[model samples]
Target chain A: MSRRPSPSSSTAVPAARYLIGIDGGGTGTRARLVDSAGRRLGQGEAGPSALGQGVDQAWRNIRQAIDAAFLAAGLTPAAEADCALGLGLAGAEVATRRERFLASAPAYCKLALATDAATTLAGAHAGRPGTIVAVGTGTIGLARHADGRETSANGWGFPVGDEGSGAWLGLLAMQIAQQAFDGRSAAGALARAVWRTAGGSRAELLAWCEHAGQQRYAELAPLVFETEADDTQAAALLAAAAQAIEATVVAIDPRAELPLALCGSLGRRLEPYLDAATRARCVKPAGDAIDGALQLVREQIRQPLAPGIP
Target chain B: MSRRPSPSSSTAVPAARYLIGIDGGGTGTRARLVDSAGRRLGQGEAGPSALGQGVDQAWRNIRQAIDAAFLAAGLTPAAEADCALGLGLAGAEVATRRERFLASAPAYCKLALATDAATTLAGAHAGRPGTIVAVGTGTIGLARHADGRETSANGWGFPVGDEGSGAWLGLLAMQIAQQAFDGRSAAGALARAVWRTAGGSRAELLAWCEHAGQQRYAELAPLVFETEADDTQAAALLAAAAQAIEATVVAIDPRAELPLALCGSLGRRLEPYLDAATRARCVKPAGDAIDGALQLVREQIRQPLAPGIP
Candidate 1:
């Protein structure tokens, strides 16, 4: 949705009018608009902006979302250049992709970039010391220690690592569908669901996979949750997914000293499947990734964060 | 290696100077030349000729090997058109690829085509009824019943089905490398071998996968066999592969009545891992896929079979 700042907010443009915080991931991009005084102005969103999907596509989606946020804020497109931008994006850890993403920058007053995992941790803990397990289209666990030393787990990519992620779950589901098609396994409820969506015949399934990527596969993940109640195979998949999430929880904070929060839509949905030990460590996130992105630019520009607003 | 027919065989030109049988797969192509009287002449080899790779590449490799065979036999390239050609090609099951391959046929006097799996089954039984599991770069179990009915299992494609094939083994090995890199699993010998070959860094690994296909992954499969003795993970992968092969065996012949032959290099290597019950159904093939391809055209052209020669 587009958001436009009110006339009063636009009038404050030169001093503190616009701050755009972007959370760009494999599935979509979200932009949160705020004034320099930390007042929430508006929010905007666009399609996938993961640099790994290609730098050009990432830039296009980011620009679209930034423009959307400006529109939502009641500001003209030209006002975007006056806004400070903080972007926490997927694939930001890869040096080459990160470099390319930054290199293709559009005009802005100021800008900062970091991995989405980093911002997720910052947002979950509200700039405090805690760990976050992000389980959206992908999965990653990151911890920001009180000492400022950071550690991470997973976040590897689709079809390989990123265990317990939506993509991983859906990938495994596809494997099951394939096995069923080959008569190596039975066509259970989950398989039926996959077949219905992916095409029933082997040739059709192959054609479906020919163009499928991480985002397309992740779209199938909801079936795992939807069918888990009645299908043993689906339940097993969910259990394995939970185990993967638990591994990330332990891998990032083996000592169990840090407060942990599941920070993505799927992560929160997988909550009931977690072990008691992991559940005990879980805490509600104080802020969202957008807040952390905003916090990122605020720190860089030395702007004051509204007291206790987060 | 190229095989050229002897001068005496070349003299029999109009009647039955040459017959070429080709076994073409994802890894490489082989051409076998024989005279009208069914006497073995020479053999030639070339690179991958799988039609799914591209019709042009397949035709290129086939032509290279055919020319090599004619050259080896002390015959000129011009003699190729006078030969009867029979091709057992991987990806022949893909209708589009098969159509393209046939449409691009050279001026061979007579030509016939079938899937490599079908040819393997025919060759394994020397034109009799039997079951064959061909597990080279890809895997497929096919059975030709006495009644002329056929059944198949697996062979869906690489990185999907294909079960215990070389590419499947290598693809699984890649997964281990990825999981180890992500700290989701320990780095075992298999993972170490993969990292050494694929590159040690995450970016390097991702780059390795960027251009990797079935053939590239199959190159890493030998390590699974080489390291299985001292590495539990590698052993586990082999055991799983064996199980997949066994599943294919059962799927194709539930009654275990048909004589079964494992037709690929990996399939033979996995023989020792098969259970005694599954192994009991196994038999050495009477001929290879090249032999079957010739027999196919020999039947089609109503050529007299040399008595008792398979």
Candidate 2:
């Protein structure tokens, strides 16, 4: 049996108004210690700590980041004990992994774990009922209602379905290169640019791509974007990306009444791509994922929703 | 004067003896030396020599490959200078480039440069004269008549077009990835595999893709093929590729009789993606692009075209 550490054993967080919020993403983990009055006392950041990676790694990352924050504030790690904690983690939707994470994370006075998206959505809506569509390394459209109802669409990984994502744009550029190679058509400068951008030769590009262990293909999307005006192929690819995102939003809810918030790297970049028609349909939210995490903690403190939000 | 070597400088070849055919592709240049006996004597390969790349590079690659073939066959490069040469160049259709290549290359007793697809079609029809649709890195449908007339369709470069080519497959795969990322829909294992195959992590993949010296991304298409069955998104992407090719063929001549010879790697690998209806209209060519090149050279030897074939 795994022994659960007793919160009472620690001499941290005697303050009744202590609170904490964490944002665990694919790239890294971040945590902030705040007070009941919404004053931020400490903040921390650490390495890549997505839960899908595994609980041990996630915990370690979060622990390191949180520890840094505490150290910076001239406090002990145990000071987190006085806080009500909220964690918005990537891949928290996977029930089994979530359970494992919840079971293993070091003790806090009170804790809640949810998807990174949820926190992002909460932040964007400032804990109000609204929808948030995020497009980062991938894409996803998520919504939460004032009545606590929720709906989600898309978020398929890269390559096969990232919509207007960088991966999607890069893939389109690849197709252009393939066409150029087949002698069916001329890709003009775009093909040359892509090959040159990847590496000097096809062999080197393939080798580097295999060895890099990064979604390197997605990186090529920027070149396509940069050359769009001069290269029709690039322009068309971008248009297709925009259209794909529009499709996702339409799928989520055809009506424009729902408050739709956009977040994530790609999401921020897609503003120009969004047609006037799509822009008219979505209401911009007020906050970001971080804000949402804080709101969730505050709400939980006010009224805990344990068995789940019905 | 860029040293325009006179075509008349070389010794003439016997009317029914040998022919030289070249397939100038993106990666490198390939030339085949065939005799009237239908035997392949010398096959040479060299670095990128696409006419679009530049006349100097093209000439250098072609000459290297041709020289290698001559060396392998115990013949001097100068000895075959009199043989008629048929060049199927990736960028031969571009008027300016074609003329430049013709002026630059070592003078054969007779020579002609045509679009690479022309060679594929001629070879597929075995020089008899018929419609041949070649689907590979790109897609093109060509109709040839015994009277020497030709009509072509659908080889536009991607992402706007290229129909049923590798470019098309790559483009579709990218769109799917984007769609998946955007939360428009769910993509299966294929997207994941594609992401994994393209360097693993987001940053690594991005770096490898965007680096100016990296290799081309088309080399990674095999990953999609490997995971096609297990990944629905990939299967769909491949299906789109086959459909694009079939569409290109249909656009060529709706009622044309097909003995549609297929070309290109994807043409062979994703054959199953072609529907039965499309397959019935397909043809397997007896010869390859090299044969077509041979036929072109032989024609130049017997009766040079009005000097406009290039």
Candidate 3:
């Protein structure tokens, strides 16, 4: 529901001209509603929205965020059919999970779905055709062709891959921590910081390799970077991380001369660490994914899908 | 307990002129008894010898190994009173646990204790003044001076620092496995081998990390290396491991060209991967750690520990 005048229930059947865009992620789900004028009518947010974990959890959060926005805008629940939803969900790349999400679709005016990376691309180009490289807890390269073709590379989970990602950096930190603990490698303050941060006794640490977790490991990565000011191992790990990032870029469209966007929280945080060549390879996007979603929604209302978006 | 009669014992009351060497490690514990003539009297083996995890189990294994050697030579347990034990144990590196082991000292005629690394050094140069760079499940460089001054580097632990050891290699393999799973890396057969070896389910693997233990990790190292034939990630890991080994050597005694004695199962397996310069830098011992322990026992029997050994 929006603060605007109600047209859905009127006998005249006035057309509703607005769309809702959502960026569904592990941390939280964010929703923005915009009309044909490109003005935001309402915005909302809620908890974890990774679809692969489960659809119930994902939609629950999405609905919560949307409901909050609608309530604040003084709209009634009866206005639900006046809006279309465009969702960019994390972990939607899996075929089975995507199918399950499509099957359980809400009875909105219209709904469309795509992977988080694809949304990131749409965001990068403001719904236009371009490529985006996201470096968060994981790494992924995605591109949109003018002819509607899409391609992707690298976005593996941590341990073996996830180049230039939080997981990659975290794995390297673990290596240095082990060396310092055993007296094989010298870490000085870095070792003490890691021990304090990781929260385990020496005996417990002796058994750390056997019982480590993703969150526990992910927690140590920032500490490694923090210690890079003086610790050799930490410094080396950072350098290695930087190299991995560069390699990922090279792997994707080796000659990225056109507009290329760097997306994700990690990309922003590690921007300074990126080499000159890699930096030169990127171009700032005109608008983000949410803006792209808004633009998508507004266009659909003005000139509805030719064949009704099959 | 020697099948061959000892010349010294022939004098009726046996003068203890021989020594027993015990090398207790994660895989197993081994004992060797040698006479004054540098001749082997008997030898024995048993399992789970690390003190911290299994004191009762370790003692049980030790007693079995020792008893078997004597029985094999048709000797009575009463003869145990005439033997001195020179023990080098794995968990001796842990301060509290080592102290506990020392407090519960087994009933032997006489004994001296140190880390398995220390005993390995004693075996390498027959307790003479020299350096030993040990590469096993972990890597450690130890140097003993004439005045008993000792210096060590590396052997930090796996997932932190182990550098060029089995645990180091195994952890690297896991990183590749994770990468392959995410599609950010391609590990081919090596990835499948690890999945099979580590238990097929990712959730099971996640759980395994909570308490996988050292032996489980050490066992997977060979599989990592075997995958190098076709897996890019495995090859990269091996190359990185080789570089780490070189870095460890440099950290040990950069200036002095000391005799580097490489030992351990991993060291033997990675001989081909090590660079020619690093190979030339090493002085490959003629025997393994157990043989070295046996040699030390034989030498000590021939010429007692020149006063200071006690």
Candidate 4:
């Protein structure tokens, strides 16, 4: 039986000089490489590594991103034993998959795992106490209190939750497009734009729906923003999404004391739509999730691996 | 090269004494068997036969339902040549799939195909000139005019269209349940019921969403009705559904001159929720889609096969 090398033994190796931070999500996996002093070396990206997709695929994507980062850094790809890895991954909140991922860790000198939300929060606050609402194709709100207590709200996956995310807006847009196609509702500019983009006929719309996944639906989100000014449907959907974002933030930080940051493609766009009080509390994130992942790695290197991590 | 047997030639067979009416939907395929005189012989049900599911699977499910009906009739399962078939199928509105289905017909004596909406209207009006709104797991409205002209509205499939459908209501309920699970929203009676039914935890809900399809979403629709009285979310959903039904009926028959019938599992339940004007036009259906499929077969037996139908 193979036993994990003890942390002290692994750290004794002379070549263990690099730290790799991974931000893995449904859309893509990104890796940032830094040295012992936290100097940024390079960054690279690969396909989605969301744990829900499959453990093998996730690992493959992470490896691909890491290798790219090494290549960009003008260094040969290092063996697992030469690096420490910190992974902030979507779907890592699910215990079974997360456990499988941790248990199957390669021969890295040291490693740590956390949900992408945690990494985003860490990055947003520069590893301090703060709140961040990450709203890209999906939505999640996380807060780290001054005392280090952490809380999260509304990060459910597409077509069900993920309110105020790109998927949420896209879903409402598609429904409006269907109503337009059936003539049950007036075809507003947003609906017309969606229909035009989706092939412009009921049959075409039907075909699109038959094959549509979260990504496909998310592709329609731009039309919602584009037509919001002239389309009541689009405006209503945005308002609802904005309201959800507000609700999410309030749930994560009820006292509104934490420095709040809105992150992701959709997050900044939603800032203008938030209520006065919430908007006043919002701040730009100090760093991205990659920065947070690097911070995570730095923390792990400074301390012993958490109990049972090996 | 093989050619379809001409309708005239196939009709000459003496064994063609039965008519089979098939209502093939996403949830299930149902078959109603009748003698030459239009007297009901038996009914049978099988798995989903929605054309969108794949023609081969749809055909297999339809055949299974027909076989079960034959067995229930206390008759030896007759060869395909002994039966004339009429199919009212969901997803038959897609021209490519419909054509493929028609082109691949088996050795039946004669056959007719129509959208489930058209067949439901036919059955509801009993071959008369009227309109019917079908509100089962999906929703559609069809109107048959006095001059034999027909029109339809809605009936788009789940997650995109199908407004006011069981799937629509259920999707909303699940979203509410997700919000409730995250403590982002209060767990109202409807949300609590859905959570209880879906295994009562965020993990269970996540698992459910991971594997959920249209059928699974439709399964939660009952909870909406079950808790509507005490749940604001349920009441709001039903009201939206009722408004959708009203909009569909108006779209199908704008003048409201035709007698209107509500049909399907959720149809009658929506009656009390309809606007007063739309409710005033509602009538009990004379028969269900099976009866219309039977009528369709009887008409085909009397008239020559329509052009372009092999």
Candidate 5:
């Protein structure tokens, strides 16, 4: 079933000399390199490699990070044929993007790929079934069950979804600021902070917002945190975000069996705002998405998916 | 004081032989042609002329409609020097855009310009001081008082504001549909309809939403109303919409004293859901935005703004 069996694989025993685990998202990509025995060798970071953004860009970033990782290990960059790689990337859930990404990959001893949320869960729980809510520029909750079935909550993307994400927080802040501008609400600390960041005048705000996307909106999220103490409306928004997180947790793991991990750009920041019950379910992550990617690659090397089956 | 004082202005009294009133919004533009005596002549409609969309496109559509209006009047298209014009155009509140739009004008006998909301208010009360809540692709409340001071609420634009608007309803429905897809909520009628319109598959949804704007979101609004009877969530969304409308009304007219008229693509449709007390202030509009523009032009012809002051 192999079109290009490795020269080393002809003996029927695998000869992978390297293992690399990669975590990629909207902001950046991280690669962790290890020996065949799973001992850490080197680590590298590169620019954003979210698959949906562009498969070519994703691969380029991944390759750059991989090269850096090998250099950090004090070796010439290893050949793709000698490496087994696992990638947990943002936007990999979109089947078409993932396929295009996979098709363009360099032939390796083995490869495994999944959405960043999936790998986050795997890494957080040390390969066991668990739940993870990642809230950054976007937000989503994912759970892996004992039955190997997976469920997810939120993570609906830009201006429409991502309920408790940084973008969501920023959008809510803007709503309040707009109402303030119209004199429908008080121009409180939150409104002032938001207006200052976006612009002060109606014309300025409209122009700034006209072409803004998720990242632009998320840039405003921090203002909410900074002004919450002095702005009741800001505090209310945080409370709502906390509620949205709790709801997502409940949705993903109704029985609360899976240990929950809230980790992303915004997730950990929101931890204190979460109610005690939801916080109680939260556990320290055993490892990160990179470690999960390592675990996934190890498994894939043991049992490779057939060529052309991805 | 106009740079191009009408040839007729030199006659000691304004001698414009014809008048035109234009109402322009996101979806289309309408031009109403009337005689110098203010008698109805003819009317014509054309493509969208919202200034925010594009100044060139707005002018092109306005000119097309104006030409059609003149033809419908069974007269040769009048020269710019012979026609006084009034325009109520969307996005006229953005000072810079309004400036750009006015700067590109054709130099008619006399020109009067205001936001569509202002002209709607002027028209709804037959040029008197009153309140109008116009809800279509977007929502806003505007009230002109006897003292000439004006108050407005909402209409904060898309993705963040314009609460209770068609776009808002569509956005809320899409939010629910996303949760349903993620197993966070039941797929009620609203969700099903939205998913169908947006594409049911996750990949399809993501691809569709990747580039959607305010108009794209507004396209899904009718589904909320269509499914309200079968979906409690849809009903609740409508109830929330009605509440938003009421809040705007109360925000603009806190004393509840002004005669309120609900007229727009969605304004009257949401009326039945308003509270009885709020509905008690409802009044039929005296005329449409075109009439208000006509009235505004009449005033401008009587006393022109100083040149370069717009």
Candidate 6:
């Protein structure tokens, strides 16, 4: 139903000779190339390709990473018709962005698209059933059931959601700073630090708020972690964030059977705050999202096309 | 120290025969006119003039309202030289905005500026000693002591501050709607209503958040009020907002000795939720902020220039 150009039907193309798995995010993009036998040929990295940034930028980064992988493998770069692709990208959950991203894909023989969280989960478990809590500037929990069903929690974005993420912690810090500014609450060290960062004046804070977004707020999270030991407000904020993260994990995989991995910069930091029972079930991830992307492409090549599809 | 132009010194102008008191806010600007004896001459209204919007827009709205007031009074529209001005406008508390606004003042014979909260308090008490809780899209409490000293609580802007304000209610509603979307919370009537208004899709919500501001969030407040009776989340949100309003009032005047008036649309709505002790101390305001503005100008004329002035 999409108006954009579609790749030629599988029957009209030669079988792909190479598989490329891409893990694309807001910070950067990574590519892993594999031969037909599933052996890793090479890996490469490039700048951010977050789908939310825009389809063009995402594709540009994706292409650069793929080319780097080919160069490292010491082989001529594969044409789009010679490769199959598996992409786990940030902002792929939004339907419109996902559609446009798919439509923009090069004429690869086969392709699969999913959210970064999905790839993270697959990577953590090495293509097995497991769960993952990714807590950076945003927070999301993903679980893959034994039956291949998947579920997600949180990851609703900043301000309204992402309760246990960096942005959430920063928001709490800002509120405490405001309360301190108005004398409604005590000006603890954390509050004072944030206030000084805002130029120690209400006017400066106003100006900051006018343009403040998730990245700007996330910059304050480090102060929360630094001051949590001595500042009551900061400690409380961390505790609440940990609780939210725990809730997300429970919501995604209530049964404690599957291996759970805490991923991302803020994810590991929250480990100490999680309850002992939940912490007992946690396991270190077997691989990264880029590994999961490779696994995805391998599966796509084996299946080739869904049943009943010509 | 401001680089902007300063108004001509008060001693250089003739004694003013008319006073114009303007209450400017984000929604609209209102103006009241009075003669030497303090008799009401006329009233007029114009578009929003909140200084946060920009100095040029604020002045444009203020001038329009003043002109409308003169027309209503059936008097030749007085030049700025013929009238002294008193303005209690939103965003006036920020020093930069205050200075810029003062510099942009039309050549009024004399002018005085105060925050809208201060003017609301002054108007509520008719320049006497009293306290007031003003809660519209934002919330602030102000108290004037018998000694002519004044203090304020809250009034921090939206999202980070302004707890118990219209925008606060709207923000809570949005969060609840998001929780419902993620299946983390039940979708009650309020959540359903909000989601429907937002096009009931995650992509649409993401699109909305990209451009959402205080005004956009504040628009959700009406749903909270309408659903509060039957929806648990809505009721809880209102109760919390009321508690915040109560806290602001208590923080401003702990003893509850001063006459207290609850002003603004959201403020009056919170009255039913206030505790018996706090509600008992509440009194109806004698006049609106426009009247308070007139009183401000009247007082300025009586005192003329300050004692140490040129």
B1-310: candidate 6 lDDT, tens digit per residue? 5242224445534678888899999999999888867788988899999998999999999988988998899987787888888899999888888899888778888898888888898899899999999988888888998877776777778777888888888878988887777666678989998888775887787778656778888888999989988898899998898888787777777677798899999889889998898899899999999878777876766555543454
Model 5 C-alpha lDDT versus the unseen true structure: 0.89
Model 5, A1-310: lDDT tens digits are 5465453343443578999999999889999999989999999989999987799999999999999999899989988989988999999988888889989999887788988888888899998889999989999998999999998888879889999999999999988988888777789999999888889987777777776778999999999999999999999999999989998998999998888999887999999999998999899889999998999987766654444664
Give one digit per residue, the lDDT tens place, for model 4 in A1-310. Answer: 5454466654533355889999999889999998877788998899999999999889999999999999999999988988989889999989999988877778888787898999999999899999999999999999999898988889878777889999888878988887776667788999899889887877788788878878888889999999999998899998998999999988888888998999999999889998999999988899998888878876766655444563
Every model's TM-score on chain B: 0.89, 0.84, 0.83, 0.89, 0.93, 0.93
TM-scores of the models, in the order given:
0.88, 0.55, 0.60, 0.93, 0.89, 0.85
Using TM-score as the yardstick, the better of models 4 and 6 is 4
lDDT of 5 by residue, B178-285 (tens): 888877788899999988899998778777788677788889889999999999999999999999999899889989889999979799899999999999999999
TM-score of 3: 0.60
Candidate 4: which pairs clash? none
Q: In terms of TM-score, which candidate is stronger, 5 or 6?
A: 5
- Candidate 5: where are CA atoms >4 Å away? A1-17, A71-83, A106-111, A306-310, B1-15, B74-76, B305-310
- Runs in model 3 with CA error above 4 Å? A1-160, A166-239, A249-265, A275-310, B1-20, B33-39, B51-57, B67-84, B103-111, B170-243, B255-257, B269-281, B284-288, B291-310
**Rank order (by DockQ, best first):** 4, 5, 6, 1, 3, 2
lDDT per residue (tens digit) for residues A156-268 in model 3: 44443466777667756766555565445666666777677654464666656445644456666787778888787777766766666665555444556445788877776
lDDT tens per residue, model 4, B1-310: 5444466654534455889999988779999898888788988899988888889988889989999998899878788988999999888889999999888888898788988888888999899999988988888888999988887787877776778988888888998888777668888999889988887876888888888877788899999989999998899999999999988888878888999999988999889999999999888899888788878877777666444564
Q: For residue A227, what is the lDDT in candidate 2? A: 80
**lDDT of the candidates, in the order given:** 0.83, 0.68, 0.67, 0.86, 0.89, 0.84
User: Any runs in candidate 1 off by more than 4 Å, and if so which?
Assistant: A1-17, A79-81, A303-310, B1-16, B79-81, B303-310
Restricting to chain A, the TM-score for each candidate equals 0.88, 0.85, 0.84, 0.93, 0.93, 0.89
- The DockQ for candidate 4, computed on C-alphas, is 0.68
Model 6 chain A: ten consecutive residues of lowest lDDT: A2-11
List model 2 lDDT by residue over A1-310, tens digit each: 6443344433322344567788887788888877679887888899877886788999889878878777766777665567677888887776678889888867566777788888998888777777777877667777776677776766645443456777667766765764554444576667778777766543444344434322566777778867887888888887877787777777666565577777877777776788987776566668666667777776655553323232
Q: 4 or 5: which has the higher TM-score?
A: 4
Give each prediction's DockQ, rounded to 2 decimals. Answer: 0.41, 0.12, 0.20, 0.68, 0.65, 0.50
Worst 10 residues of 4 chain B by lDDT: B5-14
Q: Model 1 over residues A86-151: C-alpha lDDT tens digits?
A: 889987888888888878887677788998888888888989999999998888889888888887
Error of 6 at B147 (Å): 4.0
Worst 10 residues of 6 chain B by lDDT: B1-10
